[model samples]
Target: MGGDLSQTEVLVIGAGLSGAIACQRLARAGIGVTCLEQGEWNPRESYPGDKPDFELQALGPWNANPNIRRGKADYPILDDTSDIKPLLFNGVGGSTVMFSAHWMRFLPSDFFTYTLDGVGTDWPIDYHELEPYYLQTEADIGVSGLAGDPAYPDRPEYPMPPLPIQPWGEKVAEAHDRLGWHWWPGSNAINSRLHQGRRPCVQRSTCRAGCNEGAKGQADQSIWPSAIAAGAKLVTGARVARILTNPQGRAEGALFVDEFGVTRKACADIVVLAAHAIGTARLLLKSVDAAWPDGLANSSGVVGKNLMMHPMNRMVGFFDEPMSSWQGHWGQSIYSMEFAETRAEHDFARGAKWNLSPTGGPLNAALYPLDDPQPFGVDLHDRVDKWLGRSALWGMVAEDLPDSHNFLTLDSAHSDVDGDGLPRLHYETSENSKRMLSFMAKRARESFGAAGAYEVAEQTLAAEIGWHPLGTCRMGNDPRNSVVDKWNRCHDIPNLLIVDGSSFVTSSCVNPAATISAIAARAVDRLIHCRSEY
Candidate 1:
């Protein structure tokens, strides 16, 4: 399985959400495709939610941080210089295994941020161009929610009904209504009713720990199976070393180390790198040779620049009455996007969406105090129990403006077992982001107060890792300013395509999985239409 390889029409580097969707679309177009995954296959029942030792896994490798959740497939990322550490999974489904399953789409204005708000680079493609693909991706994943929200553009109805609102969501809704702010049940990837042979969500509320019910839209549970059934092949435990190129400066395929530690080459007519933002940038930066000394497809010298992540802040509200905040379901019940865009009165260029996660699990409850002051022995138990059933956590996702200073570069000092350079993230909050966080924090406290919170705790401007990392390898109309073109094809290396979060131009103030899938869908369509170019 290591040494020699068969060349296929398409080779996808990761079996994550983008890769799976790309494989399915390519296969449907009568093209042969194969996926190489660094992690092993994870079955639905393989998730450790029901085990007695599951609670401890959160403190261990199952935590969001790769340094903390060091599994066999995980690679090290250096972040000593960065404020926010990145959290990711290397398996077939990628980070969706630990994601909150929030499936919000980017608004039309998000794509035109540079033109509309005078900040960030504008996306070469617009929302109307990707709206069809977004709808297709939503239907394929079986998203649950009500459409026709006044804040968003006109869109198709969701595949399934919205999840039942919890006590926390109801309180948030009431507060928003009183304040004349807009609120709606968030679009979730978790199923409320059985769809496409999968079971409905049972309200276990442990989605980030991995879903045991196969109801959450992890790529492994959704499109990966469809791609496999369509004759696309997948090879697990294969860590890609670099993109292999020819004298013509076109991508031929990738060189990787198999699970047995054997060097292997997977040749393909075209290659798609969907290893998330950080992994994709690291590989591109490391694939340097005499023909292209700087790096493969890095003629613009921006393969890993302009890294962005949403700066998140959480506000907690406590009540005297016991609240049923521990119900096992999709964590965020309601969301407000009234301030998702920019305004003349605001000092920030972009804004954030506030989400109410009513039932934060025990592990999260225990960890919340780490941001605040930790309580002592007997007081710890009392505090944990008090907040466990009586508090609501509001997550504010502020839009992060991309800066060249905030970027990813390979570390000269740190290398993996295969001797490839490790990714070093250099991130800091911009002045615009700082202003946004300050404004949102005050609004959150006000909102919670309006909801009758006896006491409110604000996690202000803290150093927390962002789940959505984007803009490292951005797309644009010109090769000098971007890594990829509007079609997601590498400007320097036309045969190489990046169909993941690495291709995002802006970090829209919502979870990016939906947009990632939409990009993959649109990119594959372009690939099929221009098949002879590769």
Candidate 2:
């Protein structure tokens, strides 16, 4: 690679959800922008299909645990103290390449969690501030869902109608209705019809392996392409090592190792970090300099503190009748947010949200809990017959609060192939999180029983991993306690910004892709509008 300076008005790191959006917004504003990404582009055609061995590929690199994935682009993480494994993709699209694409907005109460629930820190921004950005992101990504969900804020109709509700979805909806719970058609980032010139999903039910069709709302598919076309440069295979600052303590650019293992410097007028929670935190912690011996933006001494992950639990129900589990989208089932907020009667500060699916594909269903022995002969025949098209799985996501013990730091004992210090994540489920999971698991079993399942079984939570990592570089009003300010700019480094999930102060009890994108959009818009102030 040439040692050409990253000649741009703004340089963004990571080409994932937030990074892609930031680039698009900046480039569209006619400001020169460039994106530096560690991983290479994964062509949509390369996504795995529904073969017998197809599910194995997900376990290899798509499972979210870099250690288990062990791909060349993935970096190893030291998570011995964590209850959940970190699941993320390293390439252009980030984790959305394998995400379930359940696009949910954070409830109003989520913004005031600290004030209302007395648990997590309250976000500097709220749902109302992000509502318009949510709408814009939904249209840009072609989200499909119905409006008028009483459980959420009032918003315009979706870009398209909800995906066709299969019989399984209807069954789950009926069960929730019977239980007097609010079940709505899930808000999905997957296209229901041909919108934005992309073809509708073929109902592959293999989203985790990467969406072969352009139906899913991956950053690589939707945002990155537009940004590049609008004059944003995307430099892949550039793994950023540390952020560089000048004598005045403002961000100058970054030092990265190119794909050829050559060290280079890419300077810019402004630098944005959108490498997700762990990646962003790791880079900042590793950049120990003369002015700042701790990190680039560690003046508050909170660079890697307050890490959080949404604890998840799974419940499986085996029915006596066939349900044709293989046909529709795996994550397009009913979504219930009845327990998304905390109640005074409950000991936990926050509750959980759930989505129901048929655990699509024979191979995936065969390896449901991942520890069960493969049956042979008559046992195989019986197990297959019982679960092939007659079962449903409930994936419950419970909110986790930031704890002092749950944090990320650099591991001096381990380093990546590029000689960058590995991330040592010390995270464990909090007592409140455990209680929330237990309560949600009981509710899941009850729902299955009410849905007329003959047998309902709860999977042991040991195999579960934390999802939707957040809050390592949290934003707040207090500069002494937060890494970034309300505008997503580093308090210590005025020219530095963070536009990923790391800036989130609280993790709502839902998939956070939509929220992350909304924040990126809002941050870039604010930056451009207030550039003269800076």
TM-score of each: 0.98, 0.97
lDDT of 2 by residue, 414-456 (tens): 8766565789888888888789888888888888888888877
- After TM-score superposition, the amount by which residue 36's alpha carbon in candidate 2 deviates from its true location, in angstroms, is 0.2
Q: Backbone clash tally for model 2?
A: 1
Compared with the true structure, all predictions reach lDDT values of 0.86, 0.84
lDDT of 1 by residue, 1-534 (tens): 546679999999999899999998998788999999999877767777766666677658578788778899998888887877788888988888888889998988999898998898889899889999999999888799998999888887899988987777788789999999989997899999999999999887778778899899988888888888888999999999989999888899999899898989999999999999998998898899997777778888888899987888888888777776766464568889988889999988989988888645565666674356876677678667767878887888888877899999988788877676788999987888888888888888888888888878778655655687898899998999899999999999999999999999999998899999999999999999989976
Worst 10 residues of 1 by lDDT: 363-372
In candidate 2, which residue pairs get closer than 3 Å at backbone N, Cα or C atoms, i.e. clash? 64-87
How far does residue 112 in candidate 2 sit from its true spot (Å)?
0.5
User: For this target, which candidate reaches the highest lDDT against the unseen true structure?
Assistant: 1
Question: Where is the poorest 10-residue window by lDDT in model 2?
Answer: 458-467
